[model samples]
Target: MEIGNKEDNRGYWDIVWNPPGERTGIFDVIKGTEFRIIYHDESQAEVSFTRTWDPSLEGKAVPLNIDKRFIILRGSSGFYTYGIYEHKEGWPDFGLEETRVAFKLRKDKFHYMALADNRQRIMPMPDDRLPPRGQQLAYPEAVLLVDPINPDLRGEVDDKYQYSCEDQYNNVHGWVSFDPPIGFWQITPSDESRTGGPLKQNLTSHVGPTMLAMFLSAHYAGGDLSPKFTDGEYWKKVHGPVFMYLNSSWDGSDPTMLWEDAKVQMMIEKESWPYVFALSEDFQKTEQRGCVSGRLLVRDRYIDDQDLYASGAYVGLALPGEAGSWQRECKGYQFWCRADVDGSFYIRNIVTGNYNLYAWVPGFIGDYKLDATLTIASGDDIYLGDLVYEPPRDGPTIWEIGVPDRSAAEFYVPDPNPNYVNRLYIDHPDRFRQYGLWERYAELYPDGDLVYTIDQSDYSTDWFYAQVNRRTDQNTYQPTTWQIKFNLDSVSPNSTYKFRVALASSTLAELQVLSKERKKDLAFSYLHPSFFLSNVITGNSSCMINVLAQVFFNDQDKGVPHFTTGLIGRDNAIARHGIHGLYWLFNIDVGSAWLVQGLNTIYLKQARSTSPFQGLMYDYLRLEGPCGC
Candidate 1:
């Protein structure tokens, strides 16, 4: 077959292999295949594929395009591209009789360890060419098309390194185009809109880049600059400007005016490049001063509510004696930051100074007391761990909502709305009387204490758990419910996790997880939610899996020693089948999306069953994982 054509009296062709089969492989064949090519000079040159597919094999190329020949191949050993040209008269390779083929090869540095779903593409292209048109430039061979309209000589492939061959690389030639910066730029004081710290080096969180290889990159790029080296190309040694570091931006509309020396000290100071910057007195003062940054965490009992101010509370940081006036006085409200849904907050870009942090909430009866003593210097980023409130809970008790008591089932909180939390269990509530009018549970606990609160629920699972008198009135059995709380933050992030909810009963009840968040996040609707599990439930055959466990389904089959009801005989009982009238278990999994930092409520509610006398009972809830869930 005709393989290549003349390009201004030059012939070119590039090859690629398959990927995803093996990191590297040896072809186990030799008998019949050969590379066949008919040249324009009415001459033929052939290379046999009869040998082991590798890089060491080299063969002569037909002198086509008048004075050039081609021998190109790739293998695990290394990539080889040879273009033998006439060395009738020359200095370098004057008798070597060749120029190199411009085809470029790239190595996949991290392919063996990557999973099939995670592996990247490997595509080879010609160094002196442009890639094929309309090709997505990523993977197997990620081609960078710099001057597409001008010329490109490399073809794009799905995976140029695939073991099978179906196409060839493209061919185009041109130089990358850009010019040196023009004119000049001056640093003028910007508007007050530029919000930053008291210092100029405080570039509002944009810090300097860090690396060491930059100063020696030119030597690394081409060793020809060294007297001991001579293999460097002539052009790389002759082109462009050089700097210890260079920062640039481009606008093709006027490439000539793209960049200029702004003369601004870019906050990129390095110990070795001290001579680069000459600062003024005011500029030096800014650099000498520092900033303070940290996260705020309250005691376990104190709810990290974001709208503390709206709730008649505020976290304050101020001078030590600022609040010691005849009347309590405080300043610097801008120094305060509210906590996030996760009870985490950050104070950024504060000028270095001494300060005290204190907070006051409506229900929490206390005067301002310093939670921390800050001594900040230039560029200081401080992080304070969990703060403990002295005597976390005290004074008269207050009730946020509902009747509070022990036991998982039968809660008194109403439904949750957007603004107000109806079912809230903040810390441990104590029974108290409010003004002798109504007796209520006081939501008083030491600050930062663990709190479990259910914010919403439907009435479907209620009467079954609440109607205790129904259990004795009717001959029919009543269903049961269990409510539990856990700190999801306790589970590490980016990990697999599993939990089991088990109930011991003479009969089985239809179990449902009541939390909307849990239903949407944790896998809950019957076992094997995904087809990846080897124990396929619906339509799955392959064993390769990426997802985690969808809950282990363990049914109760044998009779219990304590509550034995079913017959020991083989074929008599007609009541029990598929987890009915027995104790069963389901493993709940909260994959990756962890729980909030505080107390997270989990509810297990059971409904009425068809069994005659079997009563629904609660057993236990347990967590088992971070890895093998």
Candidate 2:
């Protein structure tokens, strides 16, 4: 078993797996571990290596039986690897921090790495990250290559985390050796076994000339994504069967075509899922799995009275939880598929289990959860006829800022600071992934926070991608508050209005609302009324009470907020260059008594300022008048 080096104190480009001594970081190698031939035939063969844990070595080794398997088929160029992890009910309690298989190619031969069509590049050598060649940045993981072996790469920043990709797009990526016209790729046909849903971001190929098949890690999402077993709980999971694919061009024409060919092979493997060749009964075959088919339709009266086809909707089955729990769920398997243009979807080969069907449309604001649980018995073809989803809508849209597509891509994403850039995303579609973008907020808004006025401001250019803290000095960060100004032609004192605010991401932050009267306590303008305050209805209802936006009142001064999303989210998407994290929606209600016929300004305050990284990315925001209006 090849284990990685210590967490830190290791060289920049050192071979992470097995440095000097046989010192494993988190997982310990089992004693008397042996490999056994499961099956051997002219057509195919299967082999297994067993590592059993000893309770006596509880503190030393992971209290779980790790079964690693390898399979090879006739006329196949590459092999398949998978692992079965099990922790019995009597096993001692422990935390599983990280587990993965890594491959480090010969640096001399493989120099080009491809994560995606647009993300591929000829990378700098690991030595380029060492002193005299590279300069370490804010974190050890980031190194600016001052002088690289490939002079073209000089001044470019090389960070493994920079290449991290979401699980959905992480199907095939690897290193290319132009010398031999060969390609080494890690192809994950499906991510049903990986944790944190399809949008979960994990490390892919990086600067060590390293390619990782990440089964579990705390890369983008923090410790919460890492599972901890307590009181000897029994847990078992099948991590992979991910294919290690290899291809070569004999003609020596276009060696990069190997990447294109690897992509073709990836589709071949995906279509051959639930392989019937495996010897282990734990590995279910096609006959043992079930299928789900359905047609989803959306009924948003504001858009159209008739049911609209849920085009390009992400529909999936996950361990039963709340509406949006799939993003944070890690313990169970999840099967996801996009709805067709006609809103029809077929989820096949689902392992027999009880799951809740969850979905979110591309242009929709809220999530859709089927009220019932689905039971997938072997060979069961379950058809959930026609399903209609009515998004969270209570009234007509008086004013809407951005699209509610669970992404901040529509907002203004500033260009990365000239000093620090990842050339790949400069004018690229993923411009939001540039480094130090959070700091740009402080530079752009040097004096005051962003103030967007409806009809006058364009979201694409006016609204910033994220609401990050304004760095006051070297280490001090001040909380930021954005204002949305809109004019109301009339006021209805007896009606209730809905304020819908959807956040694409947030990191350990508190979003608050102070009463208009108490706004002075924080920082307010005596000329304008703000927050959820009574008796000061000069017009515009700026102070509306939201579900997650904590509203402070006179009697509840410094007490519990009327509504508080206490320290929500830990995905750290901002620092990781992720466009969004776990989705959050806060629906607030404003009474007619708080409104006036004039210009209204609602102050959206992000009250957390401990770290500059703490922030929020708004997916969309809309103020809706009463149902009839």
Candidate 3:
């Protein structure tokens, strides 16, 4: 059979994939089997199936058939094109060259089929109708468009509109556009007619740069829509749920200027984080004395009520004793402000000085003394109490107190006299003692004094026992003296001894004696002497002696029962008799020998009615053996 001219590519043909050197045609395999036919148009497409035994193809040898095929593909330029062809019965009689076979079985069957006809008139698919993939494939339908020309439906419409006279995409494309980019408005301070003008101006001036940057970021990321700007009514409606700025006026003037004004009026609502600052004295005035600083704890009613004063709050502090002057110090603390709710603030880490705390908010006035004088000592913490700001007539009352001024005291004691081998004496000057309330007096002496006396001798016995008394009476007693007596014969002539006397009272009393003796009979003694009366002595009172002593001797024989004795008798009775006088004899050496560790106890009991004057007095007496020559 003769095939069409190799260059005359003018008809559509079905594609078939065959293995190398295979003789079977694709129709032979599909003749007895069922096959599906698919057709696509620029706007819509469909797929159908027919069995070999179906009635439509009963008498026909080639059962497959497709009618009215149409496919339109669109180009970037606003135009559509299509490839047209008509299929005839029976396969074409042509030899299958490698090149021809390759072209007939291209991987993209749709493209191969379109190009086989050698016609550039391919139908262009409508922008809205064509699926993202091939025309014959199943896919979702295009979204509907909305018109934006109507003022009432500007934001309400689904499809964006534009001027059709300009670019076609500008009109047909579904995307919103703004004349001035988002965050294009410049805010400024407004006049008195604008209530929140000052604040709006401040916020815009302070934080506008940051907000502008964020808006620019959103624009760069292809945000869905431009940020909307509003003021007064518009602001209340659009950003009512959140915090936003209120433009002073919307007369279509300079957007930047209006934005600046709006920003000033814009607040973070009571629910946002607070901005706090510290207040102190004017720098110029405190330049020499050094600046005073403290923290401010601001609370916003909308954000948090429980932790309103917990850091980040507005606080004011005045120097110790000074409350009127206020200055800005640090940003370490912050607080939120709200019109409907009350707030508390705490100012801490205050300079080591005095200060008054105060707070001010819209429609409210508050002041308090942070009487907390911070001393900046090691680990010192100062709590300036909670400062609450309430509406007028409901705020807390102010209170104040004066810190007292006082000084410390000084005292001294004189040195001991070395030449006199006597007890140390202490004398505090009358002037120094006058501040007795804050002063303490004490006297120190060696540990071995025979007797000690206080100048106030007329005091009660209780005073004597307690050993401390106020010398109210200026009268000085000569016996306000401590005494120590040394009997040369009682100690070894050439032996040395050391002693210490403590002039102490019942409060602080101690006496220690140490000695070295070589005499055949040497004794160390302490005598507490008193007086006793005797009835047999005919109205006579004699001295009685009470003694504590230690006796030592080299020879064992000399350590006898009579080694030490205490004699007691009336002077008159002693004088009446000669060498053998009437007296009571107590042998301490005998009693000590019979007791363990040579310990002895003695008691002298006087009978009742023994004498008219039965009072007792004690005297000291001593005797010792001479040193062997």
The window of 10 residues in a row where model 2 has the poorest summed lDDT is 11-20
Q: Least lDDT summed over 10 consecutive residues: which range in candidate 3?
A: 162-171
Q: Name model 3 segments beyond 4 Å from true.
A: 1-178, 185-324, 327-357, 361-369, 373-629
Q: Where is the poorest 10-residue window by lDDT in model 1? A: 204-213
Across residues 320-426, which tens digit of lDDT does each residue of candidate 3 receive? Answer: 33221221111011111222233433333232333344443421122223445433322334444444432212111111011100000111212322221111112
Write out the backbone clash pairs for model 2.
531-543, 539-596
TM-score of model 3 vs. true structure: 0.14
Model 2, span 188-291: residue lDDT tens: 98898888778788989888778888877666666566777777788888877888898999896899999999999999999989777877877788999999
For each candidate in turn, the TM-score is 0.18, 0.90, 0.14
- Residue-level lDDT for 112 in candidate 2: 91
- Best model number under lDDT: 2
Candidates 2 and 3 compared: the better one by TM-score is: 2
lDDT of 1 by residue, 549-575 (tens): 222122122121111112111110011
Task: State the displacement of the C-alpha of residue 424, model 1, in Å, after optimal TM-score superposition.
Answer: 35
* Model 2 bad stretches (over 4 Å): 1-32, 516-549, 553-560
